[model samples]
Target: MRNFDQWLSEMRPSINEYNFYVNFEKVYANVDSMKVELNILNSLVGSKDIEQDFREILKRYPETLRCIPTLLAVRQHEIYAQDEEGAFLYDFSRMNYSVEQYIAFMKKTGLLSLIGEHIINNLVDYCLGIETGLDSNARKNRGGHQMERLVEVYLKKAGLEYYKEMYLTQIEQTWGVDLSAISAEGTSTKRWDFVVKTDQRIYLIETNFYSSGGSKLNETSRSYKMIAEEAKSIPDTEFVWITDGGGWKSARRNLHETFDVLEHLYNIADLERGIFNSIFV
Candidate 1:
């Protein structure tokens, strides 16, 4: 048996690759799709009689209005706003409001001054910056995928035949193994992150990495503890949870509770130590 403090001491601060910070490829693609519209809107920059110019431009080229939301760093085509006078819904996908009302939106939202004062020289550059900011919000999802990818590396090195994201029903049908012990007689639907099939046993695996502390860590530990217990009822089946990160430190008590009963629980350090070679066979 592994010592709990030794296992906890092996938790990593992060598993982020350089690309995990921001998906520049996605950011570039997003900005590229709006290049033409953003360029057309560029005509609004530094106009002395900006409102009149904006009205004339919209009358001639209504399609340029579709890019308005991006200027405000919003992904939605429709945006709602309200003031003391009334509430209005603005649609950037098409011209749902009159030109005067759009101008009112620009004036009220300070977008009019933003463009008319030449705060930004180029709309394309400004939109690229906005896209980058928006891309940062997706890092959490990217981080999770990064952990899965990292584990896949070890799985490949170990020469194991594993499938990604196998549902309980699929696992039962594929291997002719009865998983009703864990699936609650087909009433519960749970998906294992990675399912490894060896000559002797089937390993249902879940992987996660958290850099910061949260209640989610505690809940995950508790839930996986129950999963560990449930796996015992199914013959020749094992439950494996591979988790790491400094975030677990905050929830170490709950994690330790799970760790006390979970024999197959491992971390990145265990992977480096060739834990797969010992158990996978």
Candidate 2:
């Protein structure tokens, strides 16, 4: 099998396309939901007592009630079930909350806000073709430069490796760890991302660039759990997951839970400290 670097080089385009498609889906869904919610909120604006109640709730329980799933559900039910809207209005009236606080929370955490900002900036130039656009057939190619620039900026600031050797060299020099890129058959996998050997243990490190979604986390967690269990059978081997890229921002909440279950989960920042400190310190 090809090593991870080669596989990544060959697969980066497809992975990026997947990311954009997923993001677009999320944006469209959120926008549709927002429109419905806005209409419901508009109707409630006429009720002075209920409006005052909502404002109080927003002030008090911003984190719990203002979460994305709850907000989405509230809006969905308000728009679809008119009967429920009366109950919702009654509930809000008792609580003392306001619509403004809800909107503020949406603006704070929603990825749509970021997407909207990007669209506003590039709408006339890229979307409308009012300005020059680069020639590219791939979806990733269209916005790939921006993504690469972001990645490069993050790598420079965070000491993440775009190329594999930088990571391996850091490990070797800082902690006396030697790294090799290996394959599944126990052969030297040149395409492998990282294989590090310390005085007492050998570790197989896989650097995933994919976004961390709930489903993705479940699958990765299962794989890592198996690897961890399997590594125990070997007596002296270890596994480490080194994930990076902006994709992590979206599913960080779910990923955090997944990491908690795994014995060895490290991001680029953790990797920079040298594997010795990462695992031990």
lDDT of each: 0.91, 0.43
Q: What stretches of model 1 exceed 4 Å from their correct place?
A: none
Summarize candidate 2's per-residue lDDT along 1-281 as a digit string, tens digits.
22333322322222343344334444444445334333333322333454354355456543323223333333222222123223322133222335664444444444234323333332112221211121122345435344334334444554433333334345445555434322233443233245555556756556565533346755765666555555555545566665555445454554555465557765444444554344521
What does the lDDT read for residue 43 in candidate 2? Answer: 28
Q: What are the per-model C-alpha RMSD values against the true structure? A: 1.6, 18.9
Off by over 4 Å in 2: 1-191, 211-214, 245-257, 272-281
lDDT of 2: 0.43
TM-score of 2: 0.32
Pull out the clashing pairs in model 1.
none
Q: Give a tens-digit lDDT track for model 1, residues 1-281.
A: 78999889999998889987788899899989989878877888999999999999899988888888988999999999999979999999889879999999999988989999999999999988999999999988787798789999999999999999999999999999999878878888899899999999999999999899999999999999988998899999999999999999999999999999999999999999999888875
